[model samples]
Target: MSEIRTYADNRQPLDRNWLHKQWRHLRLWRRFLLQAVVRETHYRAHFATTLLVGLVQLGLGIVPILLLFGFTQEVHGWSRAEVITLVGAYQIITGLMAAFVAPNLQRMTEYIAEGELDGVLLRPVSSQLYLTLRWINVAELSNVASGIAVLVIGLVQSGASPNVPQLLQAFVLAVCGLALLSTVWSAMSFLAFWLQSVNPIGFIYLNLVEAGRYPLVFFPVPVRAFLTFAFPVAFATTYPVQALAGDLGWTPVAGGIALSVVAVTLVRMLWRRGLRSYASASS
Candidate 1:
């Protein structure tokens, strides 16, 4: 009877090939995402309240920009509408993080701290994918919707309607920029392996992102360079808007793609090293 139970509990090993393993992880992530959706759907009033709060936060973000423009036509050569477009782009990216990435990071930290990470590590898939894609904050969709609305209004008001190719280019760059930012978030969460608490570090990233709400022109040249190369603040918000507004050039676009690729590679290496350092509760 014990032998029969052991046989029943044992599962087949997964394919060892890289591509096959990745495909399996992809399917696993889809399942995790579906579970998250179902769980979120069960809390309707909570979802609604969260959505309303997100919208209110977005509204509050724009107020300072409006007040700044009231005192000047262009702050550092960025007109009111242009700055609005930047704000919308900022919201869209941050909203995406809040919906998909932030929740996972928070949960991952908990898993690490509580020594529940063994369950995640034992899965026959990429631990990074499982950790990052396990949860989705659907309520944050409100910020996404509001951001698109504001972005369209700003673009129309800016009097620059990008051609189809230009729009496509902007989208590709925006996605690359998002990838870069996700690496930053992943690296921040990796801190849990070493630090006992990382709540304050999470807030610091948000404050850094907040700086992207205005034109990069407002910042000093050194600070602008730091954002562009050392970090990716300009690529995340400014470059995408520049692409859509017909101001983007090829050189910076190439730079953003390169930065994203390098950042992602480094993040993967760091995550693996961190996992090795983790001592699970079961151990």
Candidate 2:
């Protein structure tokens, strides 16, 4: 009985410590996000230009789909509305990544290059959390807004209104998709530890992500399978859009969840190894 009580007591403190640590991270991230918003507001002209550019990009992106639909009623059994939904999902996911993930990874690379990362490493918080939460490009929210607008339009035009359960599943899948992208982004950014320039690598990743804008159905069976299983671009756009458009089924969703878990585990291991390789100038 005494041993049981002691074990229980010990577990309580560990659980409390974990919760406390999580709270601290949340507070820190909020502060950092607020700072980023304020900093962007100070650059009014730049923000305006970014907003304009994002809107223009959104408009231009729809052009190819429009042209394709004009030529044919459906591309690979995907009607015009379904394609729009996919595009909208792509925009939302990509816009969010630009708003959050890409900028942070780019900064991480810069920090690694300039040796400024030494200060970040010395901080009491998790270096990964700090690195990711330290920056934001508020102008990219314009893209987010544009994406939301496009998504609403697509959903209406599709006339395939998902029920509550399907909508929830789509949301969950979308989050998983973001996690997968972040995993890939982190793995690529880790390369900065060994290389002087990772822009070319980043470019490749960006283009690959861009490919997800079109329906995976357009690709050959082998290519589609590779994208779905190997790279997971299909999860990022196609699957989530399908979920919203109607039945996505459970198999793909389960696969995506499993992939996210495995990817995150691998990314953490790689990140730790990269940290060990880091030669901090401050040290």
Candidate 3:
């Protein structure tokens, strides 16, 4: 009777633990998203230049895509319109970075350096969440607008309009692409914990991401295989754009999604493990 009672008590705690974990994930996502709303209210009143500069940068970035169709019918196997749509999807990721992930993560390194991250360790919420949600950038919305314009132009150029089914498929791939790109960015930023300097590392990763602008096909098989399998920018950039261009079928999309999930999950685990090594200057 005592043993059975003990088992029941143990199982009760296990059930509560499961619920706690579920609630934690939900809370984390909610907090992160809500931070954007708070940031927007703060920025619109305090920092109008942030919005203006973001718009200017976004415009410069989109010029190549926006005017590409007029310059040439196509580049390599990708039409000017198709490449623009791909660029649009890529720009959505850029917007997210300029607006949220990059700015926050960069600030996080400061927290780590100054010992502020130690306070986060005492919070009921995860230290990672605290750091990630510490601030928001309001300028990223410009990238979103620019991306949409490029997408519209690309669709018009595709000659045959995408039906609803086709559009839905493209969206699914685009979302996955966004997630994959964010995953790469986060993983690289988190490497600051181990290396103690992120400026050099972050610049390297940014340059690599820039390479995604060109079609993967232009690269030889060895490089293509390396990026697609060894690194994963191909999944984040190449496949989704190709899907929009109608060059990739469902298989490549599925492959990209699967690779993204596996890579991001692994990176999350690694980041947490690295956190154990974090010893802030303050605490």
lDDT for predicted candidate 1 compared with the true structure: 0.83
* Superposition TM-score, candidate 3 onto the true structure: 0.79
Relative to the true structure, how large is the alpha-carbon lDDT of every model? 0.83, 0.83, 0.68
Rate residue 55 of model 2 by lDDT. 84
Alpha-carbon runs more than 4 Å astray in model 2: 1-16
lDDT of 2 by residue, 1-283 (tens): 3644344334334225878889988888888789888999799998999999888888888899999899999988898888888888888889888888888887766788788888887778889877765777878888878887888888899898898878877888888888898888888888888885676788888888877889888999999988876667888889888888776787778888999999989988888998899887555
Q: After the best TM-score superposition of candidate 1, give how far the Cα of residue 82 lies from its true spot, in angstroms.
A: 1.2
Model 3, residue pairs in steric clash: none
Who wins the lDDT comparison? 2
lDDT by residue (tens digit), candidate 1, 93-198: 8888888898888776678888778887777667788787778887787788888888988988888799987787788778887888888878888888888566
Consecutive 10-residue window with the lowest summed lDDT within model 1? 1-10
Which scores higher on lDDT, 1 or 2?
2
Give the true-structure RMSD of model 1.
4.1
The list of candidate 1 runs beyond 4 A from truth reads 1-13
| Per-residue lDDT over 1-283 for candidate 3, one digit per residue giving the tens place of the 0 to 100 score | 3644343333333225867877876777677668767767766744567557756765676576557657776667677666666666666666666666677777656766677777778876656656654555655666677767766776777774666656665777666766676677677778777776676666776777765665677688898887677656676566766665565577876776787789778777977887888876874
Higher lDDT: candidate 1 or 3? 1
Please state the error at residue 165 of candidate 1 in Å: 2.2
Return the TM-score for each candidate structure.
Answer: 0.91, 0.91, 0.79
